[model samples]
Target: MSDTILTLTGVQADIAQYHILQGVDLAVPRGAVTMLLGRNGVGKTTTLRTIMGHLVARQGVIGFDGMDITARATSARARLGIGYVPENMGIFSDLTVEENMVLAAVSGRLLAERRDRIFAAFPPLRTFWTSDAGTLSGGQKQMLSIARAMAEDRKLYLIDEPTKGLAPAIISTMVAALRELKDGGASILLVEQNFAVARALGDHAAVMDDGRIVWSGEMSELADDAGLQERLMGLSMEGK
Candidate 1:
């Protein structure tokens, strides 16, 4: 098996007439969290969309678990153990929390064990199990979105902006939950704006600018170097 669970080589994508993800070469290591960081409109979300096959890549290759999956359909990619938690926290507004969880449960698997694990990580899920997902607090909804994608066994997770717009306390809780997931050996490709959260969860880091990756290395190195953080991201790690 390859050390990297997911790899994108020279990947390019376009949404409508505008080009995005120009030659995005990224590697997500097995059993580790890889942080994808960038300013707004830098194609971080586009890269995730391309990997999920939600947007067809106009160029380059996507590899998962040692196989080329560039041409795979989004459903095929999901069936192959890739879970996605979009920035919008895709959940059914009218559905109860249990209903939403049930809907996201992968086929042919018993859900009790995994559901237990999720509840353990985010206790609010259990508290609001019977409540409408839309009625839940923003933090609770975010938890549900992440929980939905994690309901089944997955080789990798593509998560976009889990902490965006959250209060510091909620961000702390979210950070703790993600830490548990990471500690449980879940490999994740996370796009986050909060440098503090990224520093807490990321093992490896990649930065993007103008649709291309400009830097990548150990998260600790980036965290320690405020100057590099400013140069690469156009802001100091803590201030942003």
Candidate 2:
């Protein structure tokens, strides 16, 4: 297997005639979390969508585990162990949490052992197993979303904005859950706006602006550079 689990080279994608990604070159190292950061509408989500095959890339190569998957369908990509948790969580509002997980599991069936492991990672999922997913709290719903992805074996997780609109306390739980996933050797490509969570969980970072990557480097390096943070992330110590 390649050291990099996922790679995108010169990727160009368009959404309804509006070019969102221009020559995006990126790599997600094996067993590490790569943070994708940018202001709203900068094509962060579009980049992920392209990878998931929700939107086709007009050009460039997308390699996963040493295979070129640029033209693969979304179902094929999922079967290849690419899990996705969209910003909306993508849960069936009318279904119970267990029902949702079962639907997402491998072959649409989750074994007891797998269920135990997922519940261990997110205890709230166990508590709300019988409850309608739509009735869960925002944080719990996020947990369920992640749990559903884990119901199947996955090599890479493409997660977008897991903490959006979440409280500090809830964000902390989500952060810890992600950290645990990383510790367990799950490679993640995360699109997040919370700098704190980005700094906390990211092993490497990529910053996007105007649909292109402006910076890519170590997470610690980005965390320590206030000037770079302001320039790339539009923030300062005073939270301007």
CA error at residue 135 for candidate 1, angstroms: 1.1
For each candidate, what TM-score against the reference?
0.96, 0.95
Which of the numbered candidates is closest to the native, going by highest TM-score?
1
| lDDT (C-alpha, whole model) for all candidates | 0.91, 0.90
Give the Cα error of residue 68 in candidate 1, in Å. Answer: 0.9
Candidate 1 lowest-lDDT run of ten: 102-111
- Model 2 superposed RMSD (Cα): 1.9
Checking candidate 1 for backbone clashes, the offending pairs are: none
* Candidate 1 wrongly placed segments (more than 4 Å): 108-110, 238-240
Q: How far is each candidate from the true structure, as Cα RMSD in Å?
A: 1.7, 1.9
